[model samples]
Target: MTVDLRDRHVRAVTPAEQSPHSYFVFADGRLLRVGAGSTRCDPIAEVPSIREIGPGTGEGRESELRLYVHGPWVCVTERFGVNAALVNTATGAVRELSRADYHADVSSYSIGFLDRGGRTLLVAQTRWNRLDVFDAASGACLTERIGEVEDIDYFHSLLHVSPDSRHFLSNGWVWAPVDMVRVFTTEAFLTGYEPTSIPVGTAFGYNWDRPCTFVDARTFVLALDDEAAEHPYRQLAFFDVPGEPDERLEPHTLVSCDVFPRNEHGEVKGELHYDPESRHLVALTDGAGAFLVSPAGEVSARLPDLMVGGHGGQAGWSYAPRHRVFFRWNGGSGIEERRIQDCDRAEP
Candidate 1:
């Protein structure tokens, strides 16, 4: 089911809906909302009630929306900082979970909601190498000082919680002559817990231009300039996070050819997404091509018609029962619904 680009049925959101800060797809696609500047706007004509959640007051700047969905409750992170807010869509009640109440020095940090053993948990990390956990429902402190490490600087890289909620992984670069890639896990750093060093090496130096994402518990997909040449080459590598030094996984280059195009300034622009279930890696190139890779690092499918812009515009389809939807943005203005069917081959 390919949606036509010229369909007049497409709705235009109000000027308020154009916020690049807090756009989200919620309610299983029934709601398409955009929150930018300070106000949240419902762009779709289907949901007309514009209920204000709260004022956007914070510092770090809202990068993405970390929506925690458990049963009937939905919690959203603040525009910036370590603020977890609980919002009931049924009643529109909003509750703020502040870091001060938890007795943790988390003035500057980011948070993600995790579901641990059927209970909602808030996982946060501070700039000074401190981790904290809070009860999602009551905003009560669960654990403070989960882990403390000195000298390693976590420069705002991607922080991901595993599907099982048993571990949290952070990918960042340590401050050195050459930026080194490092991954930190919750299993190695809980309070009263001894830090266990994973046998993973510096995958690559920090190059903000390249795109990267975790595939599963021990695997990651990254695009890098393998030869340190002018043009960047995209590659996919899998590593064992908990394996020994000799048992550590080796990095493999899946794609050796040029996959992305250069911008007006001659900089390569690309985005990547990996499906852990199928071990399928999708690379959306700025040159208008999408490359699908297998777990064994093989290109399975290459769709040249798909155009993915930047890092945040890419979407993944779950293939458990194949009961999911596929949509893509045509530009900054609208989205095109691609397919609505069951995905029996991908992960959620």
Candidate 2:
């Protein structure tokens, strides 16, 4: 049941400007901007002819948790977390998969759907030493991988599969200090590979993340707060993963930056924005301001607070590789597309 996601068919929720191009398809045929766990896209065609499919058994309560989107299908779970459903993007079809397997009692912690078909893969965490996987079509477990995962202890674990399904990461899932982040080759992990961790920090114990950007098949940039073994003068560590599937993930260029002091009010501090075009990265230190740095690690520009924010791009700009520009947006506001040179002119 794989759904083909053709050109501009990608889904997004934060960058509202992506609405016209990237989209989330709904059962009712409306293509809407992206939202978490329960939002449906308004189908692109204005398909008045496509009738809305009403909720099936054990579904369509007042609240729906729209978790992940793959192709045209969206994984919908309920507020109770015990139940899960998949809404077909094309036919508006809905089915319940969570009610089966070990999920009769445990809600799945993370989900992955094969992009070409609608098969569901779920990951659930329990008791640190073990994890559970439930297969959608088979309504059972991939017992082999489950036994392997149980031997690895990932703290406060959550699972994420890469866009190409080649790599995955296990770390703190929600909003908490991103302290122990680890990346693994998707193939190696499933096939059972032993490895050493690429250290991010040591010395002092403070860390956070702006979401690791998976820029390409082999190149991704990760930001974290740490002292790293015994280094002084810097509190941040940036690691560039070697990305060879079987090789150790040693840092090709592990750069560190001056510690951006956190806000005493508990607000998040020191955000990073990478503009691929300029090959630049921006760090917005709360209460202070923002500074743009070159790939060689030199400060290039100092930016002011976001016009509306006392800080810089919170959910600010992401490099739109397709558009060759920066896509900037805040909350539900409209998005702004800008060239990297237009930094001073654009907000965040």
Which portions of model 1 miss their true places by more than 4 Å?
1-110, 146-151, 176-180, 192-200, 208-210, 227-234, 243-270, 276-279, 310-335, 340-348
Q: Which stretches in model 2 have alpha-carbon errors above 4 Å?
A: 1-12, 15-31, 34-88, 93-149, 156-165, 173-178, 193-211, 226-230, 235-252, 258-275, 282-292, 301-341, 344-348
Top-scoring candidate (lDDT): 1
Each candidate's number of clashing pairs is: 6, 18
Clashing residue pairs, candidate 1?
A: 19-36, 319-343, 319-346, 322-342, 322-343, 323-342
Model 2, TM vs. native: 0.53
Model 2 — which ten-residue stretch has the worst lDDT?
99-108
- Supply the TM-score for candidate 1: 0.58
Q: What is every candidate's alpha-carbon RMSD to the true fold?
A: 9.5, 9.4
Across residues 99-148, which tens digit of lDDT does each residue of candidate 2 receive?
33232112223444432134556544333324444464454655354342
TM-score of each: 0.58, 0.53
Backbone collision tally, model 1 = 6
Cα miss at 316, model 1 (Å)?
Answer: 13
**lDDT for residue 338 in candidate 2, whole number 0-100:** 47
The lDDT, on a scale of 0 to 1, for candidate 1 is: 0.44
The sequence of per-residue lDDT tens digits that candidate 1 reaches over residues 29-148 is 123344332222342312222112322342333233334444334555432334445554445555555433221212223455577676777665444234566776666766554345
